[model samples]
Target: MAYQCDLGNNQTVYLDNSGSQTIVTTASGSPGQQQQSSNSFETGAWTAPPEMYRTPGGVTLKIQAQGGDRWIQIQGQSSNLSDASSIPLQEVSQVPGSSQQPMQPMQPMQPMQPMQPMQPMQPMQPMKMGNMEMNNNPMEMRMGNMEMRMGSSPQNTGSQRRFCSQCGSPVQPSDRFCGNCGHKLS
Candidate 1:
């Protein structure tokens, strides 16, 4: 058997005991904007009086047996004690053929498929910078108009070289001043 009560502001609460478990459902909002939440308890859980039930959405229900009759009081987060007592809870039975169907048990989840292995990365190719090409060979390097060979040093075809005392830069032997820093060379 199911008993329903209407709360103000388009909200209705239903207590259903037709199945093995007892379910308390709260439905609110208008036709297209209706929102519902249900909380289930063991069938004999409500046999004792002054039982408190709290929904997942924070709605509190106080059920008590008074004068051989059951009474339910709903208290939402925003509702004050005075407002909760003002709303009368009347029990209404479900129509003969319009009772709600019991909820079905959830099915077991399927196992996930195995993932494919990743492909190996390809080897890196030679890189080219502005007018310069760099390869895996470390003995050779080429830039703009210059080429350097790592294995051998170039032979100097000029006379003995002189260095600037102030900047330590190599200067021409015949130069009177350092070409790099303009320092006078003896």
Candidate 2:
């Protein structure tokens, strides 16, 4: 004792009361005349299932046996009921305007360079004579505290000048060009 037969707008016709009596017939277009029939008195002008049924892209439908499930919503392209279990193998080739997605190309970028400038140098000459100033004999008055060494000392190797054997005169004390001219150049 269960009931539901709303072949109404969206359509839903499913019946199977435990055992016995079964009928299912649908018609929209000629569909090659007919595909299935079980006219048990052929009820109604037969024109429900459209309150919101649809097909063509988005589809929805259901029908189970043993008095249970039932539903159908179609908008176009009706195939009664039984697409051999809904066809979907990528809809089997149908290309009109071409569109499955895939395309890419774009690249252009290069420009950057600038830097050069360096040249200026000429100035050098200094070994000795930045106003020469140095004259402190006695090695600094004997360095570590005097010990008597009266000038005329440093001749370790230069300018002890005792000249004038005859006239080179540099004889230390007193005139005698004869020392320089004194004809004594020792």
On lDDT, the leading prediction is 1
Candidate 2 similarity to native, TM-score: 0.15
- Write one digit per residue (lDDT tens) for candidate 1, span 9-87: 7977777653344567878887679777877654443443233334433345554322233434354453433433333
Q: What tens-digit string does per-residue lDDT give for candidate 2 at 26-118?
A: 323243553322223212222222112334443444434344444444224455443323422111131222234445566676676666666
lDDT of 2: 0.34
What are the candidates' C-alpha RMSDs? Answer: 12.1, 35.5
Q: For every model shown, what is its TM-score relative to the native structure?
A: 0.38, 0.15
Model 2 bad stretches (over 4 Å): 1-21, 27-36, 39-53, 57-61, 67-186
State each model's CA lDDT, in order.
Answer: 0.58, 0.34
Best by TM-score: 1
lDDT of 2 at 127: 25
lDDT of 1: 0.58
